[model samples]
Target chain A: MGISVLRVENLIKRYESGFALDIPHLEFQSGRIYGLVGPNGAGKTTLLNLLNLLEEPTEGEMFFEERRFTDLDPLDIRRKMTMVMENPFLFHTTVFKNITAGLKCRSVDKKMWPAMSKEALRTVGLKGFENRYAPALSRGETQRVAIARALVLKPEVLFLDEPFTNIRQRDIDLFEKLTKTINQEYQTTIIFTTHDLPQAHRLSDEVISLVDGRIIEGSIENLFEGTVEEIDGTQSVKISPKISVSVITEKRGKVNISIAPREIILSHGAIISSARNSFKGIIRKIQMEGQTVIVNISVDEEVEFTALITETSFKNMGLPIDSEIYLTFKSTSVTIF
Target chain B: MDYILEGLGNALKMIVSLDSEMAEIVFVSVKISTISIILATLAGVPLGFYVAIRDFWGKRAAITILNTLMALPTVVIGLLIYSFISRRGPLGVLGLLYTPWAMIIGQTILAFPIVAALSLSATQGIDKRVEKTALTLGANNLQTALFILMEGKFALFSAIIAGFGRVFAEVGVSMMLGGNIRGFTRNITTAIAFETGKGEFALGIALGMILLTVAFSINILFHYFQKKRM
Candidate 1:
């Protein structure tokens, strides 16, 4: 494990609209990609803004490299990190000007700006785009330029909010590779937010799941990466050699699918149901989260699935740890990304 | 109709011949208005930018006050400045009254509010993201403010041009403050007012034509920048 680069304790952000983010503790290590995954309005962007020092937390403290945010000059601390907004606003100028804006602010030598901007643009596969007028560029090109603008600063920590939301599938793959290259080559700590669970799992060394402004353990508990295939005239994803679950996707390729834990119906025995996928498994663990019970099940001793059921249902079924159980869910419950 | 045609013909002849007195009047008008507009721009742009970006008490009221001042009467500004520069007033020792300096001062006052108020609107119309983007990229508050001003450059340019237009064609300030001294403090508007009062319509008509041309050109430039901004 690397040294902790950023740490937050008892952070709280309150808005006049009655939305508040209260996080107890979190830490980010140096030179590793961390994915913050959550649905819309889950405070992902808000957290990114706080961590990047774009806004101060209402309570508690944040530290960068063991220095409290309040103790460090905001300009100095912000210079060490940069954030590329989800919908980046590029300056109305040439791409070169936009990319070197930070360098100018930092009072960097004017002679090195050209080389640095070119290299950053090349990193984003936008070679020779320095002279392009920002307002004339396409949306994808603008996003790349924004990334290059941040990359040229060589920040110690880079924050990206929904970096791939506006990108096409092919470019998304390219950008994902570019992101990995940046991390591996430069060793810059990267923290990004996305609601796409699979992308988070595929890219980050750690995935932090947030729901309704709080981090939860089982939000991504049922995520599975598999190859989508049509078998026996039905579309399904083959998770393991012995497990193929039906899905409702026309896509044929490697994909990631997630089933909401609450969507799975826990049964004592397999009964006739409209659900397309049913598996018999042994419950490996049972846990409680407020009024809901989380049941971790291992099927055929190969794949694991987590299901959420109310405490009342768990008691009615009289389920216990290490007990055989039946789990069933409809194909539509699977979200492919 | 014949009287008007005769005046137009003589006015064209005088303009084409570049009458020295007429040329001097035009020069004075351009010089004083240009200097005044420049001073107003220097003072107003930053003032407008600061007000647009910072939140303070009575900001809305401040903006309302600025908007009201945009329509400030030229004569009222002349009267207010006249009192200050008059021999009995505080600034009388400078001897600025009845001179080009006096006119410049009045015009600067007349144009300042227009420039500041329009610039406020220009900066306010800028996307809020510009500030955040610059700050996230390591810009200090001053640099971020500069970046936002750059982003709204076109509209700000139009603001300055609007200020120039307001001061360039105003007659009340120049007539009252400059005392319409021919071959010295006289400008286009004052020249037109003086020549017409003397029943010498040719020079007045020529200066009127020049004034219309300048106003038309300013409008063209303003519209060009406004379009580019959009």
Candidate 2:
């Protein structure tokens, strides 16, 4: 198996302006696209700069491919890793010169220039614009040129800072297609910072969400799908399924009644007092399946509850299209955070 | 005004005819300015590069000194050099005063600070990423510095032009150091001074016209390089 490609440990950076980044630990294995999702000023760019060694960290260690990377020469780090900044700077030269700047710096084989340029341009769909002036390119085209320059170096790892930011939504498809091709073809380990949640969901194999310079939710899929319930009367909230018995929020009187379609228990009468906040609502509608029943209740004209009960339960209650039934849930099942 | 017209006509006629006397003065001006610019660039460009790139102790003091030197009065410099090279001074053994060499030395000293200070600003003005990018590309420190200098070549040229323009138009240094020696040490500015003092208005105006042309050419060259960089 391949070695873990990049590892960061207890990275901390503080500015005199009172902003700080305190990431305890983060790692990325080879051959995966790790999406770094956070709000603006959430330290995403700061983390990228630290990883790229553009700025020195205030404290902590970092490693690349099992080698100790802290205190390494920044240029050496840059040789193997490339970052495409949100707003890229194009050199005052033709596209070809800017793309070839890195190769020339490293004194790579001069004979390979044509081939490398061709491949890099093709990778980013910029094949015909080789001689164009860098300053004259549109924002999207300039970004592609920047990508081509970074990719042409054939860096082992690539960090993109909001690569899709200024591109129009309609052109996102084309951009995504190019990204997929580059990832598949180069097998380059990729880490990118973006606030586009849907883009992260579609492009990343794993998403790490950051808040206030801390990792709040990490690696849990469908995390937002968990129901958010405001605790009765406090500044607290909890997430849980509807049928939980301990659904009591920290506050006194408010709790959300949630039930998974599969977890709901339905009855024709108010049968038990052990569960709190049971409500009587008519089945306003019934949708039958092979062995399941979907009962939609109009708790109010606006609020509703949907429960999936077995056909047996529905039959025994003689639950027809307009039958009244009771919905029950315990408070203990609530998840308080 | 009529003398000015006649001087302009003579200036055009001299340029058209490639007259040797006029040629000699123009040649001397270009020679002194070019040599001084080269010396200043060699001595000052790297100094500026170092000052801009490094964060050593006394850096602020050094920058402040350089900035102060940038505004140093040309006549003051001329007087200082004049004292050191005079007949009764320590260097009188050489008898080298009132020559092109003395003028060259004065002009070089006059221009060095301008080039060095401006070069420093140019280097300092480049994006920080450009430096980091060069280093990350596996370039050693010297190589990285050279790369940045190449990228900032236009700014460097501007610095050199500003230096030459300062030196070439300077009358104080040329007149004092070279003693306005006719046919040998007489540059455009010194010649203009000499002709005007001797009541040769036509000759002084002709020299002034030539000075303008020379200054114009330098400006055109500076802008061309700037445009290429952009």
Candidate 3:
């Protein structure tokens, strides 16, 4: 969207065993919330570490604002960024001291520390916790204090590695607003990793899943094989016996296309749309994951597609396993990869 | 049994009266052991932190060597220092033998390995995210090291307290190095040993009681801080 603030070219990190992380080319735009989603051991933490400058890439180059990361001063780059790890470890001091740790390191005026710390605390719902010892805090409170600690620095880029693991949604909503402020007010770029698929879709404009060191390119992929048909003025893919979906590709013959489950719109019945891809089906199964519902639809006896939706939407729809529904998606949302 | 009862009664009376000679012995012991532990802390804390964060070859062996040194006997260290600082020994012109400074140096060596070794263990036991979080929060190498040291402060202090316990109760180093001179180099442990040998069980039992109390107090304080940390 804007000029790239951070970019990695041919990044590869090798641990003692396993493929840690491998990214051919990646760019992070300024002031954008990007979510990295993957399962455990999917190199999400490795990429987050590389982006946070916590570890050196075993191979390849990283650039910040078009300058090579190795060429720039590491301290300077790190001073402009911060990371919040899963199960945040707070210092064995008062909450106020923990929050202002980075500021003290930068030699910020001691007088300004209290105000900054209070503001960060207020932003993270920790207004009355200044005098509390860090180790005495609950897990959720410790996490909020950690976020407050990072926010006190007003870092340019924030990296979070599984920060919301086992976190409650109430705090998550407040955290969402706080992150929005960081992006809107300070123009901070944020990169966070999560195994929660719906969270990635809800929080980020762009989401990438790294599975075994390969980026999944989109969220909740539902791959479909279809025969390309060119008619009047557009091309369409016939995916199943009853589903003929309009697509924007020029390729002909048998081909494959992948569409993100989040990109699909579900309705109780057929809905009118101009983009031209829709299928009437029955709900095959309902699977509830963290904060999300996966609705499996059987368009035909031989073909089924997964649809990603929020729990609220699924509840509001009052849909059951055998409920009839219609699925619609834009041709543009279909990715060939 | 009557003599033991008399010794106990006389020792309590001496303690309650705040006897000056007994006070000097305790004071000398505290001063020397405190200085020794302080010196060990200054050197060993940084060494422990450095060893914890680095990944150089032979790190495991080096840590093993430090842990082995934690078991070093007080007399072994005293014998080594005595051989070097004795009148016929090399560089004996300084007259450090038979002085409190020699006692401090010997105790410091005895405590240094324990402090460093326990510090290493404490640091290794911390959650691994601590250092990474510090680095990501803009801490430079030294600052990051300090951050971790602060995080592990409770355990680190416990290590120091344990070292102090050792120095406070040890007799071999103080007796060998300080020559047990009255009013100048005599400490609680050496005075207790000397009085016991002279059939003066009253002072001996009294000083031994103080040593046990001090060691128990140190352990209590360490456990207090450790529990608070947890």
Candidate 4:
């Protein structure tokens, strides 16, 4: 926890098709579970592969434990780090043999195999399946065995790619509990890729959101409820699901506008308002729908917008449909894209 | 038709009575085929392993050639060995023609391709995970190869049995190369050919019974291996 376990700077991976993965920067603190959230084709697997040293990054330096990962031997890197893909591959053997396969290769003490195997099985809640054939294990059990195979190594960093996609429906709770126990007990740094928002939120200390192979939002709590756009030669950001202001007049590089909707306080109609610009628009349609009254307005024959107001505000204005209204909003709320 | 019945009866009687001469021919056939198949397996199994796992230039061509050889006509191989062992042939000074050694050479060649090609298919047909998982589990090259080969024991066994079966039942190579001289190179297949052609149906049928029994035993062994594997 005290050291920066994984340090990735300016990572970019290029595919044969010329598509590139452009992750500006990423850092994973040691002994913490970091969730990588992205849609399909967002380079999540590519990023994981690079981290596992299964593939080389096109451009970027990756560091693990203050040592450059590219400098490590491939076998040494594999021995230290383990990855469990969505579909884990199991050998065609009895469960006992499959579990002991890795250890057998390294030639672990023969007496230790049983104790080690029993502990691993119990950790994954697969207690009574020691002698069963690996292929006959249930899908969840198979994954658990795969986990056991890696867990036998006791890897420093475990990278899981969509760890719970094919988990049995009934084992979801068991898996969550198992992960929490492993994280708490082993203090293992778990880096998992998942698309389930709630699962990520539940398991992750930090979530990185990727879109179109770029990090649009890298932090969990930094989401902005707005659609970004450029208008009039300047990048402007418009907050969505609300229409408070409309354009009034256009100048060379700037525009003047008035606020619509009585929701904005007009203190004397000339007093300074938090809203920098306001606009005037003719009310096009007004009706009561689903708990709120819908008010559609046309501003300057160019922009159309909608605003929600309280029923009390609607009655106090006593305004009829198709009437003109003034709207105002704060400049801070309108962030530049 | 009468001779066919007498031959069949004598064949059964010889097996039941365990005739010493008939047993001698059966023993020679088993020895030759077993030895030839073992040699073929030793030479061809590794070739199978290489063909299945390694990627290189001409690998496909090599495998194609081996596959083509699997169907090589037995008599053609007999003629080839005959030419090499005849007085005018290159190794004629050694005078190996009409000997059991000559038959062994011919039979080994005839079975080598079958063993190698089948073993290649068997090894190649193994689950891809078997190798990848072994590698990912920290196995070095030799360990991974050995691990995969161990998992494919049944297939390797089948390949060996197939080679043995092919060589044991084949007559063209043994007859042309061994000359079927009695009390020596005359094996079960060659003995059957000679006895039937000479109107000695009893011995011919006796040899046929022993050969069929050997084939049946190999089949049973294969079944046992398969069951044990499953």
* Local accuracy of candidate 3 as per-residue lDDT tens digits, B114-194: 899988888887768778878978999888888888878888998899889988899999999999999999999999989
**Model 2 spans > 4 angstroms off:** A70-74, A218-337, B1-9, B47-65, B87-96, B120-129, B132-140, B143-147, B222-230
**lDDT value, candidate 2, whole model:** 0.76
- Residue-level lDDT of model 3, residues A205-234, one tens digit each, is 789877678676654356666899888988
Question: Interface RMSD, all models, one decimal each?
Answer: 0.6, 2.6, 0.9, 2.0
Which 10-residue window in model 1 chain B sums to the lowest lDDT?
B140-149
Residue pairs clashing, model 3: none
What is the full ranking by DockQ, best candidate first?
A: 1, 3, 4, 2
State residue B224's C-alpha deviation in candidate 4, in Å. 7.0
Worst 10 residues of 2 chain A by lDDT: A218-227
The interface root mean square deviation of candidate 4 comes to 2.0
Cα lDDT tens digits, model 1, A250-320, are 88899777798889998888978899999999999888766888789999999999888999998899997
Cα lDDT tens digits, model 1, B82-199, are 9999999899999999999999999998899899999999999999999999889999888888899889999999999999999999999998899999777999998888888898
Q: Ranking under lDDT, best-scoring first?
A: 1, 3, 2, 4
Model 4 Cα lDDT, one tens digit per residue, A1-337: 4467777888889989877888777888767887888767767878887887767888988888767877866676666667777788777778888888888878889899988898888999999678999988888988888888877767777787888887876786787677777767777777888886457767888777665567653322212333334566444334334432322222323322222233443221344555565667677878664455557666675565555566776777765767778755554333221
